[model samples]
Target: KRVGEDLNRHVTTDGSKAEWDAQDVGLMNQVNFDESTMPIPLCSCTGVPRQCYKWGNGGWQSSCCTTTLSLYPLPQMPNKRHARMGGRKMSGSVFTRLLSRLAADGHDLSIPLDLKNYWAKHGTNRYITIK
Candidate 1:
C-alpha cells in the first residue's frame, strides 16, 4: 500500500524560496510532421553532346556524349521516440546491472581524488592514508 499522498499533490505554484521549485518538469513533447505535403527531392541525369562537328553544311554531329547529373538533398526521416519513460521507474536490479556494465567499460567508480585525500587525512579511521 502507498504510504504518502501522490508526489504531484505536494507541488505548489507559489514562487517562494522554501517551496520546491519545479520548472521544465514534464515528458518531452513529440515531434510532429506533415508527410503528404512534404516534398521528397529527386535525382536526375541528362546526356549532353561534346565535340560537335559540321559536315558539308549539314547540322553538327556530336562525337561523344557527356552525362549531366542533378543531385537533390534527401528528405528527413520522421522522428520517433524509441521508448517512452512517462511514469515508469527503473528497478534496482536494472540500475545495478547498468552501473556494473558501465564500471566494466572503464567508467570511473572511484571517489574524487581531493575528497579521497581529505577523507584519508581527517576521517575517523587512523589507518587510512593517501600515498
Candidate 2:
C-alpha cells in the first residue's frame, strides 16, 4: 500500500488532487509481467565507490560506490517556454560544450544510446554521450 500511497499522493501537483485522481488511472496502463530490478548505478566520481540497489523482490542491496544525482531532476522537465527562451538552438555548440563539460564532470551519458552493455558492467548511468 505504500507504493500505491506514494503514487496517489506524491506523484501529482499539490493543488490538483481531483485532477490527479482522475488521471491516475493511466499510471497503471504499463503494469509489468515478471518483476524487474535495477541497482542504483555506481557513483562515477573517482573517489566515491558505491551505491544501493533497490531490488524488485523487495530488498535493498548495497555497495561501496556513491551516486551523483544530476543537477536536472527526474520526471519533471524544463518548462517549454524556458526551454529555448535563451535564443539558443538545441544543437548549438554552447549546448554541446556544456554537455561535454557535464560528462567530464561525471554525468552519465548512456540514457540516449539505450546501450545495455555499458550498464551491465558499471551499473546504470555512469557514462553519457555529450554529442
Candidate 3:
C-alpha cells in the first residue's frame, strides 16, 4: 500500500498519474534479463567459488574466499619530508647527474630513458626532482 502511494505521488511532465504508471512499466520492461546467459556454478561447501582444497580432521575440505558487497573506506597516510622535496624544481644537468648516480647504484635505466624523452620534448624549464 505504501509503495502504491509512493508510485502515485511520482509526478510526470504530463501531470497525470496514468502517464507516470505507463512510463514506470515501460522502464521496468526495458531492464529484463536475457535468457541465453548461463548462471555460475557455486561451491557446495562454502556457496562461493572453490579456490583451494585443504585436509581437515575428517578428510579433504573445500576452502573458498567470500567477497563483501559493502564498501570499505581506506585510511590516508600522512605526507612525509621526501614527498615535500619531490616538488622542488631542478636544472636538466642536475637531473642527469642524479640519474647517473642512481644508475651507478644498480637502479633501473627506464627512469633515465623517460627523463631523457621528457627533457628532449619540454627542454627542462621546470623539471620536478623525481625521488
On TM-score, the candidate that comes out on top is 3
**Top candidate when judged by lDDT against the true structure:** 2
lDDT for each residue of candidate 2 in 28-124, tens digit (9 for 90 to 100): 3322212233223332223343443333343222222213222211222244321211110122222233334435557554422111112222234
As for lDDT, the candidate ahead, 1 or 2, is 2
Off by over 4 Å in 2: 1-88, 112-131
RMSD of each: 31.8, 19.9, 27.8
- Give the TM-score comparing model 2 with the true structure, all chains together: 0.18
- Estimate candidate 3's alpha-carbon lDDT, on a 0 to 1 scale: 0.28
lDDT for 91 in candidate 3 is 42
RMSD of model 2 against the true structure:
19.9
lDDT of 1 by residue, 1-131 (tens): 27875775555556432242233222232111122532211112213212222212222211221122112221222342332111112233322333344344564544211111011111111111111
- TM-score (C-alpha) between model 3 and the true structure: 0.19
